[model samples]
Target: MNALSDPEPQRSIDVAAVSALDEPNRRRLYDYVSGRGGPATRDEASDALQIPRQTAAFHLDKLADVGLLDVEFERRTGRSGPGAGRPAKLYRRAERDIRVNLPERSYELAGQLLAQAVDEAESSGESPRTVLARLASQLGHDIGHQTGGSDRQLLETLERCGYEPRVEADDIALVNCPFHKLARTHRQLVCGMNLHLVDGLVTAAECPQRHARLDPRDGYCCVRIGTTTD
Candidate 1:
């Protein structure tokens, strides 16, 4: 099939929003509370989501179960309402220190691979920005085929793959390459290894390119994906 015609539904998504979310309703709950970390009542979430109270409650329960949302007891209303006797339950995005432990082999391999990307970019006279843009496109394709309808999923997947992504707002995000930074700083064995790992991931993900060669002048990469903006 023509590359243009190829369907990668998972591309250009945000991965973080998808994490800890398996069901659509549960995922919707996360998006609702995003940026608003504070607690909300069942009626509040239901109104915000425009869903039935029962449906909202069902999704909220699931989110709480996964530790994605924090649950607490608080007064709903008083005298004429349910709060006359005891407090009601509330929900919020769980804000606690979360530690992600990578396996020894994955870390060692990721470190080595990121190192290589830097060396190769340096050798070819290309800026790290250009190299990473190519890396992003490759990741876009990998993400596209796995799922669609959310940029959040794409971003999260890239982060999991070792890219440090920053969400600027609802849609746009940037990923800074630590390996490239290391290369620019230390410029040693690690840089070269990192490049290889990125390239390998692109290939394994079956992106447009089998390898990501550098193109220095433009400070941008060649693995193009269809988008409204660069």
Candidate 2:
């Protein structure tokens, strides 16, 4: 499915999983279990972390509850059928990437969108850069349309997407770049895509008085919204 056509659903990280790491003991247990690369039993966790068996079990359960760890029941004693004892609970790191960023950035979403665009372009024998710019613009237009066709609404949409828009004398500057890491490595490509994105937002919002320009600064996004020279 075209990500640009889909509704921009805000992706939420597991806060409870992050908060669970605040506990020193639980953090230690998590570190140990995660490094092992294999499912760890409560007893193994207790021995490795030097915590009581019951304590390890409790913290491990908490990790599982918040989806930081995956839990499964198994019989490691090599006894299965007949009179085998109860299955032991094993814990392993969940197959999840947890990221917590201030202001709720959606870099992963943007990255996925870009990746999909590139893949589609490759399959269709089209210019990847052209396809990427088009996809980014459509996404920005969709977001702006959802926000309402106004300059204020466009800025709000950008802020929500982690541009960190700040109003200057006669222009709006982006204090934070949502694709900062990618922009550093792929400056021209990412910046070009960002420029088209902001332009599409301005167009969709019917704000012809202001247009997006590529004005690179030391610690800000490359794209800026300013009064049109025309």
Candidate 3:
């Protein structure tokens, strides 16, 4: 179907799947990974979170094992453009987000963040929609960089973050996030805010002009690879 046509309703994430992530270390890991994109090594996680490298690696790999993270060998590239013997393995945000349900109040915190992001975007002297679009573009750009420039990789990252989008048209896509459950239950604006963020990601990478079309009234917010298509 064409993108302008009505979209199919989306379903909620499985509750049991979320419940599997109830442990403390795993919870902390999720927050850290989601806040900023990184495929942190054990030493980095330990240093940042104040945990031991062994403990951090254990937790990180646990998350990775559960399909919440992507792990692979990464040869450390020296900034000096020198050489290295063997590359270190790196773990990054997985393409498919786990949609782990955090504490309920996260909605409140996210609500505040949304208002702040929107205000900041607007204060830059752009229309709210334009600001949102830029936000999306930047987000997508960042994700692309994190995932090595694969739009499929980028889309998977968005899915993990709660926004599920399938191809619609060459220049259009449909997005459905599982977090709408939280929004419906808590009257939280975060879901909408998140939508805007994802929209911003898409706008940043896919459609600079279309990003300008984003607005908050509806609340809530992709790209293709190698096709020269929109």
In model 1, what lDDT does residue 65 have? 68
**What shift in Å separates residue 201 of candidate 3 from its native position after superposition?**
16
Cα distance off (Å), candidate 2, residue 141: 1.1
lDDT of 3 at 28: 76
Q: Which stretches of candidate 3 lie over 4 Å from their true place?
A: 1-20, 79-83, 97-230
Per-candidate Cα lDDT values, in order, are 0.50, 0.79, 0.51
The sequence of per-residue lDDT tens digits that candidate 1 reaches over residues 63-119 is 776556779987656454643877767887554312332100133444543465577
Q: Identify the candidate with maximal TM-score.
A: 2
> 102 in model 2: Cα distance from truth in Å?
1.7
The per-residue C-alpha lDDT of model 2 at residue 30 equals: 78
Per-residue lDDT tens digits for candidate 3, residues 113-168, read 54656798767776555554445446546653444234565557655554444443
What's the CA error at residue 29 for candidate 3, in Å? 1.4
Q: Could you tell me which residue pairs clash in candidate 2?
A: none
How do the predictions measure up, each by TM-score?
0.35, 0.55, 0.38
